[model samples]
Target chain A: MAEKPKAFGERYMVKPGKSFRLADCDPRAANGFSDKDAAKADTVRDAAAIDALQDKLYAEGKRALLVILQGIDCSGKDGTVRAVFNHCGPIGVKVQPFKAPTADELAQDYLWRVHHACPPRGFIGIFNRSHYEDVLVVKVRGYAPPEAIEKRYDEINAFEKMLSDNGTKILKFMLNISKDEQAERLTERIEIPEKRWKFNPSDLEDRALWNDYMKAYEVALTRCSTHHAPWYVIPADRNWVRNAAISRIVRETLEEMNPKYPEPKGWDPKTVKVV
Target chain B: MAEKPKAFGERYMVKPGKSFRLADCDPRAANGFSDKDAAKADTVRDAAAIDALQDKLYAEGKRALLVILQGIDCSGKDGTVRAVFNHCGPIGVKVQPFKAPTADELAQDYLWRVHHACPPRGFIGIFNRSHYEDVLVVKVRGYAPPEAIEKRYDEINAFEKMLSDNGTKILKFMLNISKDEQAERLTERIEIPEKRWKFNPSDLEDRALWNDYMKAYEVALTRCSTHHAPWYVIPADRNWVRNAAISRIVRETLEEMNPKYPEPKGWDPKTVKVV
Candidate 1:
């Protein structure tokens, strides 16, 4: 068999049912790209491809793309959105940001809000923080009891499978940043006057629980990543690397989707005379 | 006293306790600016100023800015966010988009979810669609019983008062796109394949209740525009006009906030030389 072109994202793919370790991926390592500038150039190229493919996908209007971004506070989820998909027509892309669930969202099953935010077919929906927060933050903050939180992994997996079966393509990216990188991001927030408003004293509380959060992330990534909706832990300490890796994966996924623009009814453009 | 310079936003501000008619503003009129190109330049300038103020606001860490955008579907809430505040650092400016209540959210008081997402001291937060949905969509769509929904206007006012008292500066913008404009927007959504996903077929159901939604918005805008937190009914049919107007209001509101950088304790940049 002929060797196929190497894929950039496969090395970072978190195999489902296999033991996943958060520490395995080096946040600083430029995995596939040779240099930062190279990474950025590739990212720009991929972002353009993603934008064009998304136009086709949007025109096709049959299937949807759901990109779930989960990571700790400074994991570049927002940055990823800006770098990769900002050019997609505003009406065609939806960004659903999940914070602590409201009383109403909590009144229902955990997936209640999650289900509402799912991209309707043909659009690209980005969940800035998602249902996985129920596992990651809830577990660390003791918001849910251990057993209850533990079961969310299966519930999430089943929920994702259902979405997959319903014509939604899901790609979950965990922006893997190093502890030092996060500290730097946090410190910059404090030290820079313009950034001060973003410095929450409570972030320190989460920083203190880093180990627990990582453990929870590890568990969630390991147990819940499925064949239908797999997880990819992108090294996110480098902005260029993170954007490049995610965009490549996204472009590949959409190319694989091979969404076609709907045919205009009745014939070729050459046969029709302009008014 | 000599007359003060006329504020750009005062013309659109909803007078507290006075009636607000959505029809009062011209959706296509480029109010204040000379032309579309001029309005866009002004918007860019205001966006830059908002960015600078937000930096100080983030640093002060004493108060927060909450900008709530409410309008019917296709009224440009998402577009406003992109145009006005997209340049702010993601960490500095947080966007909380409130969709329909989940079961858990329903169980709690409607305010339960809204309060949780409030920007902490110093950050600028944008709510794309918000708690006002209770009175607008909930009332118009029969999402809640009439008696219950009727009382929510005052309840929301008091809740917002509590937030204002606690140092969260609020600016509410009701993007007032015309019915014809909305019909045009909706038609485009249907005809344009990429735009299809954003158009829920159910939006037609809401379009059927346009008058009710308008009435609900009038009441919400009238009753809830308070001394502490006011509502601005922006002419939103033209994208440039909408962005320009909202950006001006936002920039002015932040300038009024006048967040200051904290004094460096026991030191000054000039007095203390690097070793």
Candidate 2:
């Protein structure tokens, strides 16, 4: 009898040149990549590479990337952001969450507040919830008129396009947790004394409107997922899997961007003797 | 020679405990407790702990913490918050920077907007700039009358006292960088092309009012420092030192709080079996 295949990490280690698409490649089949063990090993190696690349990007200070995360209630957007960017350099990363707008914020165009939060060049900014909310939540809750909501779709695409033109890369991730998973998590919050405070009675109310939210997200993704600012639908049932997948995607994106360290102009290394 | 006191992690080769204090420790010291190295290491470790703790706290439904960081501009408050808490759990950690108030904020009592931003128990919230700004910047800029400024200080102390009475742990850190250091950092920002964007021409105008700001801070600290909630003066001249010191102090404080895992009242661990 043939022995069971070893994990991917066990079979082969991850190298620098490899693409970070583990979900796309099966590890067990003959034509596939290495098995699960090898993949785990690859992930560890990839994490280090991601760290190095992040440092390079930070040092170069060329262009910045804004990552907008949008999803329904209990969708794990915040968790994914933390896990994915945990290993990245802090200097170039900023996370901003948009709560209910203040009177000042309401007075300005929806994008006005968001543009101010944009990360500087060579940095990464994550929007826990972003302007897309104007179209999604506002539309779902009937807060904005239909015409205004419709106009926002074009405005978002154009806004993202402008960012791209200005050398800013944008990536949007929509965490797609199954209803069962979200309910289970929410139930856990209710059952655990420590977690009880996190349970808002209003979350159940929001859950009732889940379908509307789903539709809103579907439209948002369809309309806003442009070439400049693409969206990835991530399955977030298993926390470990979600973390791994997001890390892989981010690593791949940075590798593709090929961030490099900017050389200090007019520096004569020969003049500085190294003992 | 005393054999370098058998360096803790270096010579002893012990897996160092993952905790730190930033206020009193030197970051560059030989032990893993050095300000800079400890800060980085503490961040990675605390990130995981904070993640688990937040989930537990959220589940338990406790009151949240509001950590107010106050310092002169360029004192490294932003950098400290970024490095130390970069990996902290989920969106449970919210950073609110209180800039010059808008017309609405100005119209209300100084604590009005701040009271709204204070985290509910069980969450760890940070104020990059906080209610103290009403006393610090406003007073320094002569935005309020001298008597009004004095009253605001008394009001702030009372507000923070109420928060502590209600389970909020207020950890305020004043990143105390020397004037010379600030000058050096500002010069670096101006000289480096990549960092030119970070240097706002208006910052010089603010720099000119350094003495006024310092006096304002001294008054705020002296008035607000209490048995329940105290201010920690953190030396911020060295980046690593500041990071380590803050991380250590934060870690120690949390440990002292002894936030424990709350059990589900009726759940039996023995009966829980993996399917």
The number of the candidate with the highest TM-score is: 1
Per-residue C-alpha lDDT of model 2 across residues A1-275, encoded as one tens digit per residue? 12122232222222222333323322122223225465445555666677677666777778777877776666777667665665552444677788778999999999999998898786778898899889877888898899989999889888888988887877777666766777878777676666655456656766778778877776776666665676666656655555565567667767777887565444322332211
**Model 2 lDDT tens row, B1-275:** 01121121122111112222222333233334455455667666765565566555555556666677877767787677666766662356666678788899878988899998887776778888888888887887888899988787667777878888887877787777766778877777666655544555556767888878877776677676665566766666777766665665666566556676556454443342211
Q: Per-model i-RMS in Å?
A: 8.8, 9.0
* Cα lDDT computed for each candidate against the true fold: 0.81, 0.66
Model 1 TM-score, 2 decimals = 0.64
Residue A63 miss distance in model 1 (angstroms): 9.2
* TM-scores of chain B, in order: 0.93, 0.80
Span of 10 residues, lowest total lDDT, candidate 1 chain B: B266-275
For residues B28-109, what per-residue lDDT tens digits would candidate 1 score against the true structure? 7767765889889988899889878876886677999999998988999878877887656354676777988899998999
Candidate 2 chain B lowest-lDDT run of ten:
B1-10
After the best TM-score superposition of candidate 1, give how far the Cα of residue A86 lies from its true spot, in angstroms: 5.7
True contacts kept of 2: 0.13
Lowest-sum lDDT 10-residue window in model 1 chain A: A266-275
Candidate 2 residues lying further than 4 Å off, grouped into runs, are A1-79, A87-231, A235-245, A248-275, B1-52, B263-275
lDDT, candidate 2, at A233: 63
Evaluate candidate 1 and give its CAPRI docking class based on DockQ. incorrect
